[model samples]
Target: MMYKAFFNALTGAALLALAGAAAADDLVLEDAWLRAVPPVSPTMAGYFTLRNDGDQAVELIGAKTDIAGMAMLHDTETTDDGQARMVHLSGITLEPGDEATFAPGGKHLMLMKVDTIPEAGESVEICLTFRDREDLCGDFPVRREAP
Candidate 1:
C-alpha cells in the first residue's frame, strides 16, 4: 500500500512537469545542439529528442528565437521525385505517454538567418508553441554546435 501511494505521487509530479515548459516538459533533450554552418547559409536546424510525458496528446505549433532572424517549425520530406526537401511545418501532434524526436530529417525547428555562429557550450533559447495553445509553451535551450 505504501509503495502504491508513492507511485501515485511520483506520477502526479510527472504530470505537473508536463504542465510546465514544453521542451523539457513532456520531452527531454538528448545531446541537443544547433548546427554549425557557413555565414552564407540561409538557415540552420536544431536537433533534440522530444519525449512525451502526458496521457493525452500534444502538438508543436510554432517557435521563436533571438539567435536568428526567424524561427519556425520544419520537416525534411522525401518528394515523389526521389529528392529530399525541407518543408516548413505549422505544428506536430504527439501521443500521450509517448515521445517524438525532433531531429535532422524529421520534425524540427527551422532557424533562419543566423547573425553569428554560436560557440560550443553556449545555449540558444527557443520557445515552442503548442496546438492547444493553452497549456503548452516550451522553452528550448540547446548547446551550440561544435567544430
Candidate 2:
C-alpha cells in the first residue's frame, strides 16, 4: 500500500510539472521592457512582442503590476483633426502562430500612477491576462531604449 501511494504521488507531481511546461510553451514574450522616465513621472510605457504558439486563439484582456496603481493596454492614433492621442484598448486577439508588437507610437502597455519607480537597470514584474488562458508574467527591464 505504501509503495502504491508513493508511486501515485510521484506520478501526480510529474503530470503537474508537464502541464506547467506546456502552458508556458503556449505563449512567448520577447524583448519586453519598460521605458525609463524621471522620478516624478506618473506614467510609463512598456513594449514587447507577444507570440501565440498554442493551437487555439488567445485574447489579451488586461495587464497588472504592483509598481503601478493601474496597468492597461493602450494605442496611439491620429484623430480626425490630425492630432495624436492615446486611447485605451479593450482587448487584442492573436490566433495560433500570430504575433503582436507593442512599441512606441503604437499599441503598448500604459502603466499609470506609478507607485514604485524602478531604476533604469532594474526590472519589474508584469502580468498579462488572457481571455482563454491563465495569466502570463514576465520581468520587464527598465531601459531608455529598446532592448
Candidate 3:
C-alpha cells in the first residue's frame, strides 16, 4: 500500500513539472501562420502579426524554412520605373509596444526557390535569427486561401 501511494505522488509531481516546462517556453504568436499556394507553384509567401512581450527590443533578422531551402525577410516596393521588386530585409526592430506584420504584397517571408510545396494542412518551421540573441524557431501551419 505504501509503494502504491509513493508511485501516485511521483506521477503527480512529474505531470506538474512537465506543465511548467511547457508554460515557460510558450511564446505569444498572434495571427501566425503560412500562406498557401497552388500546386506546382514555384514560390510562396507567409504572413503574421508579431508582438514582443519580452522586456528588451528584438530584431528579426533572417529565417529558414523547410518548404524552401531558404526563408528570407523580404519587402516589396514599386520602383521609379513602375516595376515591383523584393528586397532582403536586414532586420526589423520592435519596441516594447510596437508590432510588425508580414502580409501579402508587402513585407513578408519570401519563400523563394521552393523545393516542395507544402500541403494545404501541413506545418512548416521557420528559424529566425535575432540580433544579439539566439535564433527562434517558430512553427507555422499551411492553409490555402486567396489574398
> What is the C-alpha local distance difference test score of each model?
0.67, 0.92, 0.76
lDDT string, candidate 2, 83-136, tens digits = 888899999999999999999988999999998678899999999989867899
- Determine the backbone clash count of candidate 2: 0
All candidates' TM-scores?
Answer: 0.66, 0.88, 0.71
- Which residue runs does candidate 3 get wrong by more than 4 Å? 1-27, 78-83
TM-score ranking of the models: 2, 3, 1
In angstroms, how far off is 56's CA in candidate 3?
1.0
Model 2 regions more than 4 Å off? 1-13, 79-82
Each prediction's number of clashing residue pairs: 3, 0, 0
Q: Give lDDT tens digits, candidate 1, residues 1-147.
A: 999999999999998877655544455435456766665777778766665675667776777677788888778888889798888777677787666677767777788877875654556776666676443333344444332
**Would you give me the overall lDDT of model 2?**
0.92
List runs of model 1 lying over 4 Å from the truth. 1-27, 79-81, 133-147
Error of 3 at 117 (Å): 0.6
Worst 10 residues of 1 by lDDT: 138-147
For residue 107, what is the lDDT in candidate 3? Answer: 89
Give the top-scoring candidate (lDDT): 2
Q: TM-score of predicted model 3?
A: 0.71
lDDT string for model 3 (1-147, tens) is: 899999999999999999755533432455657778887888878877776766567788887776686778999987889899988998999876667888777888877889788887887887766787666677777887733
